[model samples]
Target: MIDAAWLNPVIAFSIGILLSFKLRKISARVQSRRGPLIWLPDRWHDINRSKVLQPLYDIIKLFSKQTIIPSTATPFFIAGPILALMCAVLATLFVPVAGISFDYSFSLVVLFYLLMGEILFIIMGGISSASLFSAIGGVREIDLMLANEIPFILGTFALAITFDTLSIQQMMGFNILINPFAALAVLLSIIVKLHIKPFDIPEADTEIVNGLTTEYGGKLLGVLETARIIMVFVLIALFVDLFLWIPSSGALAWVIFLAGVIATGVLIGFMNSLFARFRIDQATRWLFKIPLLVSVLAIGWAVLWRYVL
Candidate 1:
């Protein structure tokens, strides 16, 4: 537990940065683009960054730029990303990544709350920007969050009811085998939560400019992007922990866990390349429809198997 206090955030940040770069490369490959260069660069120019370090470089570049705060914006424009980044890294500590984590009852609940906080703060950043575009993006995000979180919770809790435990560590197993409906519901929710395509309503640049971060730049934008990178690490790791968990320990376990993460990222990248964006209403409706129904049904089924039958 004590070790997790320092190690978890360090792991999340370090690996999160690399995973962010790799995921971009994955997307680029799916689209048949060359992506970022793999070797260390000769000049560190923006146009041709080293594949492994490009995302980190982008963050540094953003940090070095001028930070502008609009007169209409509130202090939350400054506070939101910092809070959101804190929430993301904190959430990572609750998840078992290659057996390094802090575990106790209801960590799953805590994790969900933290992720919700992350989203809320991002929305706060947008709304505080005082741009109509940001407001519209915030509203769209609210809609997607409302529509997606219900199914996410339903699927997760259904598994909890089946396992009769609230601790994520206690809940580990081949969960997808036992509860495919819950699995599907959660996967769909993950796509929306990660803001992947087809469901990427809020950040649909074609419609809402840069969406939530439309009014942000410099260090603030860098902080927000850092938060996003951490989240990408956390959510995929959470799914692996919950649904495809390994029973081993030590170096081998770490290897398997990382392999799972990369595989999942690749899966998401393909989704990003293949699907077109969904309109806000369409996105919300899709979540509210089959995914929500399946989640509710999964919960009922789990209860029936666990308690009634």
Candidate 2:
């Protein structure tokens, strides 16, 4: 028998692919973390094939293609996306699916560190591609990381303070009710993390020829996409686990959790459709200036809830 947690990425990839059908109405581009997995026109669908599986098919197509590496890229090029996928899979063990997860006392901390490390790995891989465009994309990713990591920490930290624990397994409930601000802050940070519209400067595909992915092709690119689709599921599930309600067992619990995940994922994809990409300076400035304040207020609220109140 295999670990139950292994099913999450598969489920998430399916959901992401289903979501792309809707996302196609918004942006035909595949620049999102999971949105627009494949933008098939109405006429492009095969009558026998379900479009919901298109993302899966896309990955399969890439896996079947030849792998190519740039002459300028270092040995680390192959390692980067693999390492990032490892981070995502590791993080999955900490995030519950229908209240099933393998988490420890400080797993929340570990989860975040892994998510952050995933970015570093991607940056390492992207820059190693040695294309000037890839280099610029890496810089943009670093800048965006600096800007958003703050709110990401603060929002989750606020939750830690309120719950008085760092174990994610011990912190399941409708936490969004207790601190909507923190949840909102985390949600905003996720938009940046996943590179939705406006905050998508890091991989502004139209302007940078697919940004950090500019130099990647074939199986290498497929690995990156696999990591991406998995992370989308992992992060959205993390949000639901932390901020929404999910009982410890039963099929109903799974349904509720899946509903929440789908809703949230769609919300994120909707954001991807709503705004044009932001300039790097504007994006970073907005992230730091705006969500930071909400996160600060969330911390204050957490302090009051945990202590004074």
- Top candidate on lDDT is 1
| Model 2 alpha-carbon drift over 4 Å, by segment | 1-3, 6-22, 25-48
Write one digit per residue (lDDT tens) for candidate 2, span 1-309.
Answer: 777777766665566556545555345444444433334556656643445566778889999999989898998899999999888777777888778877688988999899999999999999998898989999999999998999999999898998889988788888988999999999999888888788878788888888898888899899898888777777788899889865657888888888888788768867887788899998888988889999999999999988997
Distance from true position, residue 96, model 1, in Å?
1.3
TM-score of each candidate?
Answer: 0.94, 0.90
Per-residue accuracy of model 1 over 50-122 as CA lDDT, tens digit each:
5687888899999999999999999999899999999998998898888778888989999999999999999
Per-candidate local distance difference test: 0.87, 0.83
User: Which residue pairs collide in model 2, if any?
Assistant: none
Residue 191, candidate 2: Cα error in Å is 0.9
Q: Can you give the lDDT of residue 74 in candidate 1?
A: 94
Which residue pairs in candidate 1 collide? none
